[model samples]
Target: GLNTADLPAKVLANRALLCSELGLADQRIAAAHQVHGARLRCWELDEHPPRFGSGAERSRIEEADGHLTHAGGLGLLVLVADCFPVALSGGGQVAMLHCGWRGVAAGILERAAQEFDASPVAFVGPGIGRCCFEVGDEVRARFGDVPEAASGRMLDLRAVIEARLLAVGVRAFEHLDLCTSCRSDLFFSHRRDGGVTGRQAAVAWLD
Candidate 1:
């Protein structure tokens, strides 16, 4: 499929093609217009069915950086290139978050944690690693208390997120150590590609 971040006609065509190929044509897939914020949206099965692939339906999907739902059959999706895609699931509900530096700084993970019925299990996906995600002093200042926030100028987002997960009481946590910028053959990187690149998706659903 094409970059999940783009919803142009071609991207939509690619999405439809990919869905058909994956036997997901009948699935209700929800997506959001990510603004690198900490906004989270909740979904109900009948009232908030996913609207991601079609032109008309796409217009109605909300603009948010994260999604949570206890409903089965609805897939919460997040698009990422260099940013981490985190999934939290437990107690019958699930949340998928697009965790970039800005979103994380804005407490996106903490916000998602509050929606779970129990202490959720967390899975942090591939993203730009510390070796590649170098940031300036200003960005690092935002995470002043995070011990793993930076090594000199290199930012370790996984470390930042892991620390927060622990603080939020999520113990059963796992993180994919892969770096998007380092593994060009397997993933895309907004920084590595100079801001013009495709995106991979992280999706979660019940049942």
Candidate 2:
């Protein structure tokens, strides 16, 4: 489900619903102010969980594009419209990443992979696929001549993510393969919606 807009009250209400469905307490959900960069922050098991209500919102990380956690009952969420959400889990830890073209080029996956002692299993969630993600010369130059990263004038963002995961020794991985732009009924696409869109969340936590 997409949490519509940046309205705090509405977004919180939607988050509360997701928390209820996931069997988690509202205060235990930890999110970040995503900047579409490769910066990752670790959620320690011993630290206090962030509060969600008014006056306590400062507990959330101010600037980060990814989160890694070895703790249970603390949900790590990455909100996305057209960007890929990559979830990793193994060896008692889990991580969630917000991967757009910039984040991928900045090595967000490789940075997150180093946090796990072993090669973790990955799940690549929905985003804009190559069929609809058209890019100009500047964006294309950042990805080189990788076939999956370029299909004529289009760019496959997930393909770059997959290659990064493989390079980081993550062999066990799954792609949701649903393009957000292509499937408006199922996802929120910023591109398709002309920059006014809700955000879908990819959440992970240790059980």
Candidate 3:
């Protein structure tokens, strides 16, 4: 569900379940108020004091679409419904990004690449696919005249993201290829469910 929604109790409960499975404490989870921009925040456990539990919840970073950290045992989270959740890890660091069309157009992937010291393996999570993500000329224009991104009027969001990551020197890339819009049983899609829908979270942390 929408883990960072106004419902703090429900959000905490959902997080608790994930932390239990991962053998992590829910208090160490860090999140942001994603604004569909290219801004990325990097946190260090030594330099910046770790925020945990209710403190972390209260101090959710604002106006950032991406988060990166070298801090071990600290979870970074990004919530998405139709937007792609891009996770990157390498050289003892990890990052999670909330990438929407606006974020892609604004160069969020490239901005994220700047945060990594070495080539990172990228894992792209599920989102709307080209089959159902039809768009107009404006959206298509942002990604140029690439065939993979433009299937008639449909836009392949995943393709655009993959191209961007590759261009920024990410070699090892994996995509979940699951279309949230089509897989009604497994995902939440803003397009398929209209404006009112819950969000699925993509979370990553260093071991």
| Two-way TM-score contest, 1 vs 2, winner | 2
lDDT values of the candidates?
0.85, 0.84, 0.82
Q: Which residue runs does candidate 1 get wrong by more than 4 Å?
A: 1-9
Model 3 Cα lDDT, one tens digit per residue, 1-207: 433334766766766777777677765776777788998888778643233335354545466888889999888888899999999999899999999999999999998887788889999999999889989988899999355778789999899999988888999998899999999999988899886777888889998
C-alpha root-mean-square deviation, each candidate: 2.3, 2.3, 2.5
Which candidate number would show the highest TM-score if scored against the true structure?
2
Q: Best candidate per lDDT, number?
A: 1
lDDT of each residue in 52-167, candidate 2, tens digit only? 43335654546889998888988888889999999999999999999999998888999999999999999999999988999898898888835667878899888888988988
Q: Can you rank all candidates by lDDT, best first?
A: 1, 2, 3
Which 10-residue window in model 3 sums to the lowest lDDT?
Answer: 47-56
Q: Could you tell me the lDDT of residue 53 within candidate 3? A: 38
Per-model TM-score, in order, reads 0.91, 0.92, 0.89
